[model samples]
Target: MNRRESLKDPDDLEFFDRIQKLHLSLDQEFLNQFQRSLPLNEVLIDRWERASRLGFGDQTSIYDSSLVLGNVQVGKSCWIGPFTVLDGSGGLSIGDHCTISAGVHIYSHDNVIQTLSSGRFPIDRNPTTIGRNVYIAPNVVIAKGVNIGDCCVVGVGSFVNKSFDSNKILVGQPAKCIGEVIVTDSSIDFKYF
Candidate 1:
């Protein structure tokens, strides 16, 4: 059902909406609990955080909001776009001063391979991690067993397979180094990463 019908529906949508609203309100409660978390009740915040985050704070964001991280630590002053999926199942970490564009998918496992091996089909996913000062464009797919170094840029619509060192601009399928990334007051250069 659409938003309008769902909002007006009485059977289940109403209940769903109520539950969602309550869940959202829990964030405020979480903040309050965090503030009130004493040495004696430090675990309270941790428990609340665990209960609230469904697989690492599934909050799609851009300018940083209430984040949920599971073995994944994101640094300060970064722009993570909406619908950006950062899975730390195998341990994902995002560094400071980065821009994760919209529709970016970073996987930790190779589902297609595991499907061909064992019985685990669609759910068998892997881990992925990204480093600091990175600029990942829209539609970038970072596959498993890959680590992107700091001060790098992944071009739009690129697919990464292997890991790379610092100071590079990656693009294309099975991404290759296009150039370096240089940022200045005048222009952002990709030839000097």
Candidate 2:
């Protein structure tokens, strides 16, 4: 028998079988609705359970493939998607109702100077904060010391290196304000520049 087969106890075998069944069901459902399959870990662990384990606020869900480092504080009703990195070695705070999309990386520290200086220079550390109701798109990177204000939408694949005010639509390499978000009771709109 194979090494894997020999190592499996009865309980382990049963658990693996259940996991396989769950994956199939979930994959079918996801394909029907979104034309995609659920990530393996997402099929195994409930998102809310993972969030609760990390002390995130109520109703926040962080994917199993996301990596969250030191001193990160996330508020309620936020969605942290798969393959993202939240580097909080210098402290990071994300406010309520935010969507940190897939492949996003937010850093609160960097070792560029240290590495270039052959360990003579110390790593840079700074706080990175994301305000309430922000939407950071897929593959975006937010650097250390950047504070994004409330209701901002960061476009996909953008690289944000500076702070931005509330209600801005930001995009591009060193993301620039390209539009504004207008919000009123029962209505919301985006006005592009």
Candidate 3:
């Protein structure tokens, strides 16, 4: 009757059915646990598989919708969320156990000078580094050459343009250290200023 019902290959229909079922299961699980749904591309592409294909470290998972450019190095057990951008054209390194939230953008180069001077100047390139055990909240942007030290927390929607030492909790637009992170064997504390 319908075109799908009259498909030439039964295997194609079966494959589509399997994908739908997997998507539903994943969606339901996410809804129950995180009160969210999986993105359509995420349903089709396995995050860990994609990360493995990109040569990320063991146990690291990057969402299918995330864009990763050249020379990006991600360490073990990191979670790179959907719609994030990792611009590694100038070299970007993210250390172990980091959580890069959705909509976060880490840049290693910028064309500000070149664009402002109408191509008279070259694009500035620099390395960006994120140390171990860091958490960058949603919609945050880290500019080129900024090094975020270990055990740090970057608040949501902050624009980080400078380097910070370890155990800092950074917030605000030109992100500043508003707190310190104290890590113990079994607990972690944030001491805000």
lDDT of 2 by residue, 1-193 (tens): 8634865598888887787788899878878976878877676678889998999999999989999999999999999999999999999999999999999999999999999999999999999999999999999999999999999999999999999999999999999999999999999999999
**Candidate that beats the other on TM-score, 2 or 3, i.e. the better one:** 2
Worst 10-residue lDDT window, candidate 1 = 36-45
Error of 2 at 46 (Å): 1.1
- Which ranges of candidate 2 are over 4 A from the true structure? 1-19, 25-36
All models: lDDT? 0.67, 0.94, 0.94
| Best of the candidates, TM-score | 2
In candidate 1 the C-alpha lDDT for residue 42 amounts to 29
Clashing pairs in 1: 108-126, 108-127, 109-126, 109-127, 180-190, 180-193, 181-193
Question: In candidate 3, where is summed lDDT lowest over 10 consecutive residues?
Answer: 2-11
Candidate 3: stretches off by over 4 Å = 1-36
Looking at model 2, report the run of 10 residues with the lowest lDDT sum: 2-11
**TM-score of model number 1:** 0.60
Clashes in each model (backbone N, CA, C under 3 Å)?
7, 0, 0
- Per-residue lDDT tens digits of candidate 1, residues 104-182? 8777655575578676556454456688889899989888768888889899999999999888989899799978877
Pick by TM-score: 1 or 3, better one: 3
